[model samples]
Target: MLKQAGANAWFHKGDLRRAQAWYAEALAGMRAHPEFGMEMWKVYKDLGDVFRRKGDNRRAEEMYEAAIQSAYDYYKPFKNRELAKLNCQLGTYALESGDLDRALAFFQEAMIQVFPEFNNADPAANPAPAEVYTESWIMDACAGKGRTLHARYLRTGGEADLTNAARCFDLAIEGVRQLKQSLGNDAAKIYLGDFSHAFFEEAIAVNFLLWEKRKDPVFIEKIFELMEGSKSSTLQNALQLNRAVIFAGVDKDLLRREEFLRVSMAEYQKRVQEERMKGETKDTSQILVYRKKIGDLEREYDQLLQKIGEEDPRFKSAMREVAPVALSDFRHQILGKTDRVLEFFMGKNNLYILSFDRQHADVRALPLASGVYNELFEWLARFQKPEAMNADYADFLQTGHLLFKQLFGDLAFPSDRPLKLLVIPDGIAAILPFEALNLTPPGAPPVFLIERAELRMAYSASVLTQQENWPVKTKEWVHFAPEFRTGVRGLSPLLYSARETEGVYGMTTFSGRSATLPAFLEWAPRCAWIHLSTHARSGGNGVAPHVEFYDSTLYLPGIYALRLSAEMVILSTCESGLGTIEKGEGVMSLARGFSYAGAKSLISSLWEVNEFSTAGIFSGFYQYLKKGKTRAEALRLAKLDYLHSPDRPAFEKTPWYWAGFMLIGVDGPVRHQSPVRAGFYGLCLVLAGVAWVIWRRRRSAGHSSLRRA
Candidate 1:
């Protein structure tokens, strides 16, 4: 056991040589002893950890699996507290192995032992709410199980998985509070604090994923309070990234990603060398992570090579892969993403994209829910490698570039040359610390980086408001060509512009002559991509009219106000995702209106989107539209762009300030064809609703006159 522990310490410090020696000794000792004890488990765990560190996850998984089995056999009969800890470790390990069912089983087993001692009831069947539920241990089980359930939902989309995730989180919360009270040593319990924090974070993430990949600030509001009213960088980064993807906007996060520059390339190499010399190999728990953590170094090396090769353009390579998004003839629909086709690549091939422009230096990892598969990534590399080797590489690269630009449209080519990233939320917009990979790595595709920072927009705004101005900040003479520029007008009383009548639902025929569909509302019949509504924001406050018809009546904070049909509708409203709640009823809001109306999901504001920042946000928002990004991913990206910018005090704030915009109920990998009816009914609904608007206007006039008299 001591030898195994020594090995792990070595591995953790990045001294693979010493670690291997230690493991070899432990392995021999374990084999000779053949005992059912700590020595055996330690040997297996340490061995696996080392292999995984060396980029051998497959072998590591096999070893870990054996360790888990033996540990369980050794501990099952004793029901010891330490056994519970091992169970947690096993559960986490299984998840890393991509064996979700097995992972869930381990977590459940842990929870079973925990229930009576901590929860006072069996959580396997149902969550038992009670004042007696104490022992932070049980609460921890609930959270662990909840995490498993949430991940299962991502993998399978089973309603049971989602519901259980919610239930477990709720139970965990109840148990945590009760435990704190019973223990009478609240502050001293670091375990309780850590458990509470992790559970809360996981719960909020799960809820947001369930409700449609948009972080529900409602859950976060409570979680943030529970953990000593302080903030965790983990939570902040998760949230900021979430906002970025959902919004497709920009901010300091993009430019500050340049912080990777501060990370010395030599320093990275030096650290690797130091680890080797110290006889330790840093264990990232898994080889995948270990490699990814240092992906920048390899990328840097490749870029150096590419920069040298640039002397002769023909000597340079062209690597291209088609359909990372899977917009091929075959169809697999998830979320509402099946409607469009496009992609983005991080390489120096200089794809022809002749039809349009397509290159972004700022890239972030997509969460597990994004419609990309692990296998697909490897497949992409395999395909591109061969493509790069073709005699037609240059021709195909040019043609492919042109085709990509044409297919993706203006969004792909925001400019003819280098893209001018607009900083939002506000900071300098630089390329994502990256250079094309010169070679296809065994795992993820390689790329070089200059710097990486959890991007935050360093914008300038004394106060938040409804209008956003995005004038050209670059000396490069960039301008939105009028024909290519889009002018959108949004109107919905449930949003930022009309809070006095927050829950009110009415009609409008303001488009002129309701007998026939008005020109404004009739556009859906033509070939179009989006249905945007700049409306009011309601919900979040939990105060509303109690009107069943409008979920806004429930008045939860940070939801959109308007619901449009079967197309992509920018609620352009605020806090509509948050629903009004009655004493015993679940929350409801306009999100449902659009869901029922056949709309994919509403891109809405959680809080009021700063009006002054709208134009800039719209730019990225439109880019996503052009790129054919799914509603959710697009909005998330836009929000991220806004939060990471540094142009102004307000321009580069978090989603909380303005990037809280969310796309409700619309995330899947490959976008599907916007249902054909989207063309007809989408336009029809706007036209029909206009009359309702007029009627409401008339009634308002009458009420005003009566009050005056």
Candidate 2:
């Protein structure tokens, strides 16, 4: 194990020579022991990777073949899956080497290994078999086959080949959807989502190529469906399941048991993390125990969900494969006449953008600029270090304008009205600060994208449409602003959070020591609006992102277990909107955590935020909310106010201060019935009741007089 670990460490550091040496040693040692035979395949695979990195294609193929043989000989139970994966790796290698025939054969063999039924099918007749298989490895095989066919089509200009490639992609995506639905927990589903993101991108690209070649609207529609199907699918599934459980009338006891299991799993996960943080002295046995407990709880929870589904057919149907909203339905139901959606899917060769309004939809592909992904990371880093931007304002402006043009230059916006644009970003574009993009030329006075449009973001058009009527349990707001004056848990004091709390009104406030995790759990679900003004850490080193309370921190899993009905959640902390990017799943941030816990909308920071600036911006944000502005408009107005504030220093007015804070999810008004309005309604009801009583008495008296006559 140590040898293998050493090899892995060197491999990640790009020390191919050192990694190869360690892997060779590990392979020799494993070969010596029959007990370690099952693990030999991994050492073989590692050696293959090392050789591949060194560009020793012959040696790499030999190592890969040896790994497959070792898995077949020693790993009997899961040998099929292992074989499929190995075959797919070889297929990729063949494709990269431009051996189209060899690549296609390897990929088909991979698919057959997983689903033996495919062994008899003719590869040329139908690349995607009708038989459904749930294993994720099949997705990889289908993707490999599709890519191979696509390459062949490009070379030979064969229409049949292109059509077969599209079919292969269809099977790949269906496999993804099936695997996601099969998962019992969100964490597993989210992790799985990262693996298949490239498949979706490739699928979309292939479909787009078909659309261009054949001029068929069906191909265009397929691209949109693929985009919507892959984006934020876990979140969409969670939303659907919640709705199904509620509407299916699952028993309260069963629901309670499910929640209990989830909480238990989260607690054990946290315990494992805590134990692992003990470093070299950590108790391995205890960590193992915690893991076992978590696994057991997950299994139990899955069974509970299954039982619920069995009891209510509605739940079972709802939990079936998720279908993305059609493009026409999305435009009609989700987009206003003035609204447009700019959905992006970044492929290996091109960045495809789908622009749609209420009445029109268009798709365009642009060859990706070299190092554009690196440029995005650099831009985000600059936001974290504002002084860098201040030093080269002109360069910053020019670069930002260039990026804006690259991303949005071809789209035509309506001239008569301001646009309400919803941007659905994929891949590295997830963390992009769209509002900061300068729309004007470098020499011209900066006109940011935010100035031309009221901007909001969503995971997908389907998610946006579903959130339109998400239930809000209460009209009340709750605020938690903990002052970490003692540096508990190594956190600095939030000097302005207290001030921020003071400036806000009509909220159930928990400040200082009173703002604990328990308090948050108690009140967060009951309130429609929640504001947590404290410190937070972005996820790293295997730890999930967490928000610090006075007594404890709530990690992502803990947040997921919560059942919140908040219309909006405000995370007034650093990098609350940033986390380890999980390709198709977007950022695994605290913002997403809250979204999983049922928050319809969120206001979170993209970078380390200035406490004072955050306080001022949110004060105005709530004020705008009080005035019945949409959440997007309110946030926009607040940022604009902060940017134009005369009292703020000129340096503070840069995009760094205001642009990092963004609103994601449903951007609608916070509906609160004021005390004055409530009193007026009560008075009107009372007056109407009195008039009814009087009319009833008069009618009775008139009837008595008539009888006497």
Candidate 3:
């Protein structure tokens, strides 16, 4: 038999493509040799890596799954590390496709089969103490999944999404720390990758979270530890210059510009004064020169001369050297903080929130709830000045039709028609006076804007007592269309004295999910940008289940975690985002489940989403999008307005109502199609009419000729 040593040598030599190909060939040749079960499984893993590199997710998942289920198992005592890795991928797809329950099930099932080692703050806390896992493998899963989850959290804004991410980071740090303590003696090399990447990623993730949470710079300081040994790259430069920006927040108490100037100048002055001390006495001319230098130094220390924001040249200089790791880190930084929660008011970046209605007089934290409006403007202002991400910001802004186009492209700002944002009840617009506000669509005018409003039912119809304040007494809410379209409609009536009006389209469906109503079965349609399912959810369980459909689905008939389906799904019913259901079963709630689902995002209700607030939040969200604001921008504005209601300020200010709605599709394109394709047959009718007329003329001429003969 061929020696394992030779095969491993090739793999270690960085000949991945060659090694992978060799492994493939060897496995194919050894297929008849059933005794080489474990070897065959290794080859399959190699193939999975190769396929993954080639951008074939399907093929890679297939190979990995096969290895875990069969080939590796067929061998003597297969490794749990490899199996766990494959299951993670499988769970990703299910999560993305709106089956959050399924996704969790897959992950839990995979973890059970794999006997994974816990590499957290306590390496000794492995659930599977009987069969230990290597640190290398744990790190492998942690690093890869943590990075992916961080991105996911920003897009979706689901607390559950970040839960495991925190776990992974802790495990990574602990695993590494433990390994450092037990190097060579213990089998911890397997987790080296996780150890290497976790600290930095976690620091960035936490910083971004804090910025979103408190909008303070102190949280950013927490990341300095990661730059302890790293060089000045994009991430490093971002971190380096961040000190100035962070200082601005606390600057009220701590002279920010002065501190920077003093520190930088102090170091220079100290060096100069030291040199002067060493040198011998010079001529009067030298004394004059030193006096002139003193004048320059004094001028440099003046705070007035230094630019207040991005105009500071020191920032530019500090960041000129773009570090690759730093750049990647910065990217993560931006990705982590962005939110779709404020999608209710797609206001101008410079536009301030103003409720002329007087009812919102109770508003106080209006500024805080305004989402990213202030932040985006700050960044926009900074972009005008020197910064490495100036180009990146420029590109993003330019991507928009109006402002962005003015800076970058020929595209115009999005039409007045709402941006087609699926507003969730989780936003501030929900708290608005729905009746007072004009929830009507756009009228034909200078701004060709039309807002399509759709409400997401996060909770199921079964248990809605949680929202006792919301009395569903009005038929107007249930009636999506007018009552006139009650029965079957065969024809349209004439505008003058007509018997009936336009009826509801048949394509639209309004039916209960099922009789049993499984507690959770996330079913987000790929075509819909927003999904609304109503169901009760709780977070009191050891096993994390992000989402579920109904009560029955928990553990009885279906037993699934609520999964997500679209960019945003409004869990209007209950605490859908709560981390309920047992771990391994999946997210008992639907929000987290859908984040894993393909929809790319979700918006969930809290303890009990106020029906009035929920309605207003969604109405304004769609209306804002109609005005062409990004999801994050709109949600932010709406939240700001809700925060204006002074009664709820001190305790409830975290734009959770506004920011809770996440953008899952941030990484992917909105899967959609134009009307041209949906109505292809309508165009074909013209061709058919033309053909029929031509045939009639030919037949008439032929008959006339025969009659004449």
TM-score of each: 0.31, 0.82, 0.28
Compute the lDDT for candidate 3: 0.38
Q: Tell me how candidate 2 scores on lDDT.
A: 0.81
Q: lDDT tens string, model 2, 1-709? A: 7899999999999999899999989888887877888788888888988888888988988898888788888755443777788789888888998999989988887887787556643568443455766887888888899999999999999988888898988888888878877777777887777778888888887888888888777886888898887788888877777666555567889888977887898898788777777778999999888888888888888889889888878778877765578987777776752378889887766778888776566688877656566566766667877898898888788888878887786666568855788888887787788999888786898988777778888878777776766766577778898888888778888877866545344567898889999988888877888888999888788677988999997888888787777778899998888888776777888988888778888888888888888888888887776677788888888888998889988899889888888878887665566322343456778899999999999999999999999
Clash count for candidate 2 is 0
Pick by TM-score: 2 or 3, better one: 2
lDDT digits (tens) for residues 1-709 of candidate 3: 2533445566678666776667766776667777776566666766776666667878877886776666545633544555656656656655555555455555554444454343232211223323434454444344445544555677787655565555555444544444443433111332332235435445345444644566444433333223221111111222233333332243342345554443444344333433443445524455456546645655764334234434555543543433222322322432232211111112112111111111110001123344444343443332222342233533332222132211111212243432222222212223221111122223311111112221222121101111111111111101111111222122221111111111211112222323123211222222344334333444332222222222222321011112222333444444555443221112234454343232233455434443344544555554454455555445544555564567654334222233233332232222232122222444567778999999999999999999999
Model 2, which residues run further than 4 Å from truth? 1-94, 105-123, 127-129, 245-248, 277-281, 313-318, 366-369, 412-417, 485-490, 498-505, 672-709
RMSD per model, one decimal: 25.0, 7.3, 31.9
Weakest ten-residue segment in model 3 by summed lDDT: 355-364
lDDT of each: 0.40, 0.81, 0.38
Per-candidate clashes come to 148, 0, 115
- Where in model 3 is the C-alpha error above 4 Å? 1-509, 512-530, 541-551, 554-565, 580-590, 637-709
The residue-level lDDT of candidate 1 at 473 comes to 18
Number of residue pairs clashing in candidate 1, backbone atoms closer than 3 angstroms, sequence gap of 3 or more or interchain: 148
